[model samples]
Target: MNYEHVREVDPAVADALEGEVQRQNDTLAMIASENHVSEAVLEAQGSALTNKYAEGYPGERYYAGCEYADEVEELAIERAKELWGAEHVNVQPHSGTQANQGVYYAMLEPGDKILSLDLNHGGHLSHGHPANFTGQLYEVEQYEVDAETGYIDYDDLRDHAEAFEPDIIVSGYSAYPREVDFEAIQAAADAVDAYHLADIAHITGLVAAGVHANPVGTADFVTGSTHKTIRAGRGGIIMCDEAYADDIDPAVFPGGQGGPLMHNIAGKAVGFKEALEPQFEAYAEQTIENAKALGDQLQERGFSLVSGGTDNHLVLVDLRESHPDTTGKDAEEALEDVGVVLNANTVPGETRSPFNPSGIRAGTPALTTRGFDEGACREVADIIADVIDDYDDADVKAEAAERVQNLTDAHPLYE
Candidate 1:
């Protein structure tokens, strides 16, 4: 990871790359949507495939010298099919957002209604946030989690679906802690003759490992990021039945993007192969267990976790109830000072602004990748709780930073 070859041509860029590697090695990455990929994945992502231009699917590319590109892309698509059990798979979309765009472009016309979860309630910006293209192109209706229980109100979602008569219903989430009921969401979509697009961007690995309930068969379309939880390189994927394959392939390539990022697709193939091994199941299981331990420790320290605790890999802690004076940004900065890197997220019933919300979301996917167990994650949670308890205290921050260093040393990521 030294980038010595890059140093000769561009010392500044090489320095930044080396600095980033060192930063990851030193800090705790608790961000729910992030994970560390294997060196194999890293190498594949930095391959010469980046220079290739394979404009079409395997066996039907527009480019002449696409033999290796076709091979890598085919491997990725096949592995993804095996990982998620979909009839058809597209490994071309540039990102999870683009994956969602591919579905919308294929199945939806402009001004068609979109029913999705509200952004403040753990839903993604691609799932109909006003700033995104989906919100701009379609008439959007939102469903929310129960304010008291912190779970999706499935019945309410059904009611909203019936009322809105949306053309598509979006499920899966970004910061949510509980497992989504994709079947229930599918039922809601079916009741209104709507399409179901489950964006399992955060739980792709969990589902592939059978740690989380899969949405592939139930939803009409399934989309996800290959990076989060999956430990693949940065890319997005789409899966659907054979009937929709024609529409999806074109929608992703010529419609939403031009040439695919073949290097990232190579990384996806390598990571997906790694995930197929038995150890990946253990990793996914430990990820959920670590989240539970982290949430339990946080609660024991008097922090209020949304939904009481987590069933998945993330825990959303509302700082308003635990530390009323501290904003999520304040806690985020303090935790960063102590080497725990997570995000300040908006809770279900948000009272503060989106930029500096009232909640902090943490997860175990990256820590689990670093071979952390429940005990290790509990210790990390204690450090986090200490930071929140004494966010302004320099002595506390110093002590917490020392403890985080100890944990990072024990885990030894990318070493």
Candidate 2:
């Protein structure tokens, strides 16, 4: 993985790149939105196709010398269609957010009503956070999870939709730990004559692997990131019925994004191919098992998990109950000092600011990708409990770091 030519051209950038690889090799990555892509995907992303300007879909490019680019894009589209079982798939959105934007632009008008989950309650900014352009452009209203159960309140969502009469209703989440009921949300959208855009950005691979509920047939529009659970490429995808293909393709291309990143599309093709392999199914199944194990281990340590436990790849720990004095930021920094990486998150009924929220979110996809199993995740949880129990204790952090090093050594990445 040495960037020899990069060093010859730019030593500083090369050092940063090498350091990042070493960092991934050394640390545990529990961040829910992140994963380690395969070397094949990496190679494809770094290929010479990055130089091409493929401004349109596969055979309809605006430029010449695009035959190879057309081949790669076509492969990516077909593989994605196979992976997700969509009538139409657009593989060119730069990110998951842009994919959502494509759906919005395709069907929504300015100031149209949008119904989505609340961000502090496991929603995404692209769904309609005030700081995002979605909120600024649309008339947005939010639904919440059941504060007691920490699950989406579908009945309440219906009530909100009925009252709001939104143009689009969004399902799927970022921090919630349970499997979503896409049909229930679809019903809600249908009752109100609203389009449903299910953003399975975080659980794209889980859905494709058939471990989680798929929204393709249920929802009018489906969007996901290629890199998160899919481990494909660092890009976004949009899926819809053939009825909306014309609207979506133009929305993604001439409306939101310009020329596509053909190299990343090549990476997506390679990754989608890898995901089609039998081993990738095992990997996907194991990822959920690891998350369940991690959550159970955390619970036995007296930690409070949002939604009680996980049915997917991540767990959300409510710090307000178990560690009343410790903010999520406190636990986050302390754990990072010990080489266990995760993020501070807001839990349902959050009382703290979003920046220093009252919860910590952790996932097992990256660890599972590094060959970690249930036992390894339990050990990691024990170390996390140790650090959070005594974050200020330097001796505790030192011992935790030692254990982390041992675990990382046992399960190496990028080699």
Taken over the whole model, the C-alpha lDDT of each candidate is 0.94, 0.94
lDDT of 2 by residue, 289-313 (tens): 9999999999999999999999999
Q: What is the C-alpha lDDT profile of model 1 across 1-415, one tens digit per residue? A: 7698999999999999999998999999999999999999999999999899999889999889999999999899899999999999999999999999999999999999999989999999999999999889999989989999999999999999998899999999998899999999999999999999999999999999999999998999999999999999798999999999999999998999999999999999999999999999999999999999999999999999988999999999998887898888998999999999999999988999999999999999999999999999889989999888988889999999999999999889887
In candidate 2, stretches whose alpha carbon ends up further than 4 angstroms from where it belongs are none
lDDT score of residue 353 within candidate 1? 97
TM accuracy, model 2: 0.99
Model 1, position 251, has a per-residue lDDT of: 96
Model 1 global lDDT (CA atoms, 0 to 1): 0.94
How many clashes (backbone atoms < 3 Å, residues ≥3 apart in a chain or on different chains) does model 2 have?
0
Off-target runs (Cα >4 Å) in candidate 1 are none
Clashes of each: 0, 0
Model 1 CA lDDT for position 414:
81
